[model samples]
Target: MKSKIALLLFFALTAFTLLQNRKITGVVTDEYQKPLAGVMVSVPNTMISTTTDSLGRYTIQVPAYALKLTFVLPHLTTQQIDIGKSNTINVTLKTGRINLTEALADHQTVHRKVSGSYVKMESAPQTFMAPMQRYQPGETENYNPINENGFQVASQMPVTTFSVDVDRAAYSNTRRFLNNGQMPPVDAVRIEEMINYFDYDYAGPSGEHPIAVSTEMTDSPWNPGLKLLHIGLQAKTVPTKNLPASNLVFLIDVSGSMSDQNKLPLLKQAFKLLVDQLRPQDKISIVVYAGAAGEILKPTSGSEKMTIKEALDGLEAGGSTAGGAGIELAYKLAKDNFIKNGNNRVILATDGDFNVGISSEGALQRLIEEKRKEGIFLSIMGFGMGNYKDSHIETLADKGNGNYAYIDNIQEARKEFVQEFGGTLFTIAKDVKIQIEFNPRHVQAYRLIGYENRALKNEEFHDDKKDAGEMGSGHTVTALYEIVPTGAKSPYLSKNDALKYQKTDASDIGKTDEMLTLKIRYKKPDEDQSVLFDMPVKNISRPMAACSENLRFASAVAEFGLLLRGSEFKGKASYRDVIARAKTAFGKDEEGYRSEFVQLVKTAETLDNRKETAQKD
Candidate 1:
């Protein structure tokens, strides 16, 4: 009788244990039916939790007795659903208010007008308040410093200098946040990148110069009283078939943090696309780092696609990151297999987490700065999200005289590697610098729309030794400036006392019709000295509606960025304004990139409205 009781007890306990380990699976999305990534789905009051994948799908083992599940994300309302008698639960989260409030707090000088009166935010009620929640250690991604450009007096500071940047990482990263139904952090909104992501219809180079320069002036869309100047640079195009031979090194990060399917798995697929585009004469080498650095494959001809693909397939993620060592090894390989007068580059695909060795941004930046002197350029490809160190990745590329891109999906990989092959790999001009001298005669005050981090001292304009940005084949760069016309009464103008040591020279104030003089300095891919070109732009301003479609579209992107950043300078700019401007400018968008922009605007508008309603509720 005792033995029988023990057997029955064991069977009962076994059944109970099995019942407690039931599996639950589901998908999470916004009301618009778009798959949301990074949504935290978890069993209430338990440690069992998981994040939705890129496809918004998740599976977790939960106790059958679990009563409820919770979904949470930054800027979105917390949602709880009862789990009674259900094996699967599909959830849609609504927008919440806390995010914009925090964003506003970050800008110490920011203020918004309410009821025709400007109230100091420090004393204002917490209109967008919410319960504070603690965040996980690796939840936040690093980004470069962002300070909106302010007005500068042309007379006090005549020369505006900056590097030419073409990196489009900020655009895709912003898209990721919005697609997940969250507004992107202000630092993630780089207006320059957002505008440059789309190709414009600027004229190509027509002469011996490696890049062509174009300029246009129009009435500002955001502030009708201000004048907007558009400056453009189009690099000479080199057909892929006629491009020079190539030597490339693939540096991959397989850190423990990269174990997610979206990290390592997506990385492999991206590299395969590049492999498919390689030529017989091009060479490829693979180097991977995880707790240590090592060469995974010898430098092989690109014609051996199968071999490369196999090597990529064999990669697995584990251990901590040793990004510094990996970079050193990749650069060494590129140097060993250096192809003179050919495209030699080290392409690093990582989340930019360097935990083990030389992980500090300063150390890593110095290393890249040193290696770039060898004429082997570097290009950074960012992947993954959690614990992503964007600030470090951007530093590596900027100091190494290379470009940076973030790959969020396979389609982006195709856009970068296949469609823009020549522009991605082949550099046409290096150390490209732009310095615009506004005529104190025709301009009173001016401010650049973006390129805050790329600004340089006026003296650095002519310094060939100073590093700037690079231009790839067929690449186009656009910059906008808002100017307060001479004698226009505006709050942005600086109020300065008359100089005690200097006297005013007004002889040439209104003699010429020149609005500004644009000076460009650039070096041939392999040259050390830079060639200079100067062009004076006349004050031939046109109405916003009468400007080229390119100007209109670029302005719309800038407006969208300002809204996302919550800039104090965003005067009367709304999502509706952006949609209207973009609709008129969506011309010859064969690739549908412009159309996509319109959709993004609509989504943002809807999300904004949801947040407002949530606040009211």
Candidate 2:
């Protein structure tokens, strides 16, 4: 009788165990119904996880009590679905086009991503967001300091000059922080980059010039007492087929520090996406550095996509970082296979950790400066976090006459590699500079919103030898200015004593009805001399509500940046106002980036409030 009882007990427990365990499978794809590789599927609060393969298929085991499964990828909106009684779930993930507020505003309940972007009920239980985790022990990240620009007297400084920067790395980096439930470092917020991250409906170049300039003016939203000026430049878009292509080298970092899941694994997937978009006319070479640098793949046509992807897949993380050696090898390959007047560029994907030979910032700068003069440009794509050397990577891009972008997720990679393919690799114009002369007659003082690092001297504007920012094909650049109209009262405009040498009074005050004169200088990709475009901005002011989507949206971004930086010039700026303004200005945001910006703003507001409340406690 005792033996029989023991057997029965064992059998009962076995049946219960089987009932508690279940297997779930799913396929994930993007909005366009394309398979999305590298999507992470996992059971929240557990170590059990699996990733979608090249075909977007994933399988994971879960406990019967597991009510929800979370899907996370930096490139797409996060999703948490209740397992319920289903054995298979087909997930459709959307990018910025999805409304993130539906989840946050409706408590813990979230909506699934669909082609039409319609909201539907989800099975997940209500839960709070995860806590923030910034850095690990002994981890250090670097960023250059930014000194805010204060109001300048139009009489003393009537003209402001700066290079047109199209790099949007700062905005994406900031989004990473907000998504992690933390406020980004103050220095990380570049107002200009944040504004330029979204595309505006600016007119493209039509006539002789390869670029177009447009302007908008309205009363400042943050400070109703001041006037705001918005300037934009749009480069003519070139289709992929029409773009020149040849001699492309990919310099990859397979160092020990890049062993993180977000580093190497994400990188492989990102590069695969880029490979899919390549043309047969273009050729790619692979150079990897880890302790020492070597060529993995010789110059091969883009038609051999599998060979290139396999080479990227075989890369492993180990040994010390030999960034300098890798750069030398890649540049050598580029120069050897140099295609005259064709696109010859090196795309370097790394975390900017260069501890090996030729690692110093000065050395890197000098190296890139030399390589740039050889008619070879560099594109630095930053990956991973914690120990990310942004200051170092940005220097290389600025000096090499290239561009920099931080890829925090696979979608960001798709953004630079697939979406902005032509612009990412081909340069339409170089040495692009913008000079704005504020009419002292109509303006008293003016302040530039950002571009502290790209400021140029008055003489540099006309100097052809002076290197400035480069404009990629189909790229758009925007700038903002806050000026106190003549006779307007403000504390920023300090009264200076009468000048002794030159006349302090405004000489061009009544010269024209123009509030400012805009002058842009750019050079053809192969030309040394620059072509100039000049126009005068009329003195016009409209209410913030009546302004164009371009102006309103840009102003809202500028305000959000000021709040992030805790600027003294914020002047009555509030999260509520920013949200309202942005909501109204999200005109035809096809990609939904504008919607994502609003979500980030809300997240920032929450984080800021939490900090304030904790301090009070």
TM-score of each: 0.78, 0.86
Error in Å for residue 427 of model 2: 0.8
lDDT by residue for model 1 (1-617), tens:
99999999999998897567667789987655656655667665544566665466778777777788777654456677888787899988655532433322322221233432223356322111111222233497898889889998877777899999999999987776675567777898999999999888889999889899888889888886889999889999998888988999999998777765457766887898799889999999999998899999999998999999999988878788898889889989999999999999999999888898777778878778887877899999998775778888888899988899988765577668877888888999999999999887778889999999899998998888899999999999999999988767777765877456643354545689898889999999888999999888998998888898989999999999999898978888999999999999988765456776877777788888898999999
lDDT at 116, model 2 = 18
Candidate 2 per-residue C-alpha lDDT over 43-151 given as tens digits, one digit per residue, 9 for 90 to 100: 7665456667656788887877778887765536778888899999889877632233333232332333233122324443221222113454356778889999999
Question: lDDT per prediction?
Answer: 0.81, 0.82
- Compared to the true structure, candidate 2 yields what TM-score? 0.86
TM-score for model 1?
A: 0.78
> Who wins the lDDT comparison?
2
